[model samples]
Target: MKLGILGGTFNPVHTAHLRIAEEVRERCGLDRILFVPAATPPHKELAGAIPFADRYAMVAAAIADNPDFVATDLENRRAGKSYSVHTLELLHEEYPQDTFYFIIGMDSYRSLGIWKDFPRLFELANLVVAARPGIPCKDPLALLPVVIRDQFCYHESAHMLRHRSGNIVVFFEETYLDISSTQIRRLVSEGRSIRYLLPTAVEHYIYRHGLYHNDERF
Candidate 1:
């Protein structure tokens, strides 16, 4: 089985998140894409102190229509900070026979050097870095950490990097939706319409739970 893992805060899963998963699934021939909402993200704080259950529920609602997409509480179940390396390690142990593809946006890929055990990520799964709006990743290899750059051989034709661990890093250009979680939250806080920005279920969930309305940061 070919599984793709997309982990995020998902304060409220938006359409762009779903679209990215769909695009990567189709382009990479993935059987399923697991949406793992972080209970406590390691990098940044959750905007409104929204509970993990709410975030996870929104993710479930957003991807409910897609049979190929799944929502998992893998990060929620684990203790401490939600680190990508630990998540990948757990998944590898659980599905030893399956090939894993860790999906990430270009923005996140650029900051991967600071992630815990980031270099080991290539050993665990193939990376599919999808392009995001306003983030120009003209030379993906140049963005990689200098220490590990020599371990990968770039394939110009395929826009991929072959790591010594046998896993590959693919740069995928998917449909860019300018929508962002921050934008959605700001709109909701300002009492503006958040419709069409995300799945109807997710939009409704945010309102039903009264999230982001009191968030002063937005």
Candidate 2:
């Protein structure tokens, strides 16, 4: 089975998140897309101190109607910070026969160098870097971390890079929905309409729980 892993803080999973997962799943021929909400993201802080359970519930509700989409609490089960490398390693161990495609945005791809055990990520799974609005990654090779740059060879025709580990890194240009969790949260806090920005189920869940209602920052 080919699984696409989409990891995020998910403070509240928005429409773009679901669209990206679906786009990547179709583009990469993935059997399922795992929505792994980070328990404690290492890179940045959550917009508000929303509990992981609430975030996970929102993800579950957002993807409920889609049979191909699944919400997993793998990161939450782990003790420490939710690191992509660690999550990938765990996925490999648990599903040895399955192939994994680590789905990330172009912005994350540009900042890959700072991630823990980032080079090992190629060894664990193929990378699918989805293009984001305002983030241009025209030359994917040039953005690679210098230390591991030589480990991959670019195939211009295919627009992908093949790592020595046999895992490939591909760039994808999917339908761009400029909606963001930060924007949703901000809108909710100001008592504005958050309709259509996310799933109706998720919107209802957020309002029921009063999430982001008092947040001062976006």
Show where candidate 1 strays beyond 4 Å.
133-138
Model 2, 1-218: lDDT tens digits are 99999999998899999999999999999999999999999988887889999999999999999999999999999899999999999998888999999999887899999999999999999999998656556688999999999999999889899999999999978799989899999999999999999999999999999999999878
lDDT of 1 at 216: 79
Candidate topping lDDT? 2
For 1-218, candidate 1 gives per-residue lDDT tens digits of: 99999999987889988988999999999999999899889888789999999999999998888899999998888899999999999888878999999999887898999999999999999999998555556677889999999999988888889999999999867799888899999999999999999999998998898999978774
Q: TM-score, each model?
A: 0.95, 0.97
Q: What is the C-alpha local distance difference test score of each model? A: 0.90, 0.93
lDDT of 2 at 96: 92
Candidate 1 least-lDDT 10 residues:
131-140
| TM-score computed on alpha carbons, candidate 1 | 0.95
Once model 1 is optimally superposed onto the true structure by TM-score, how far is the C-alpha of residue 98 displaced, in angstroms? 1.3
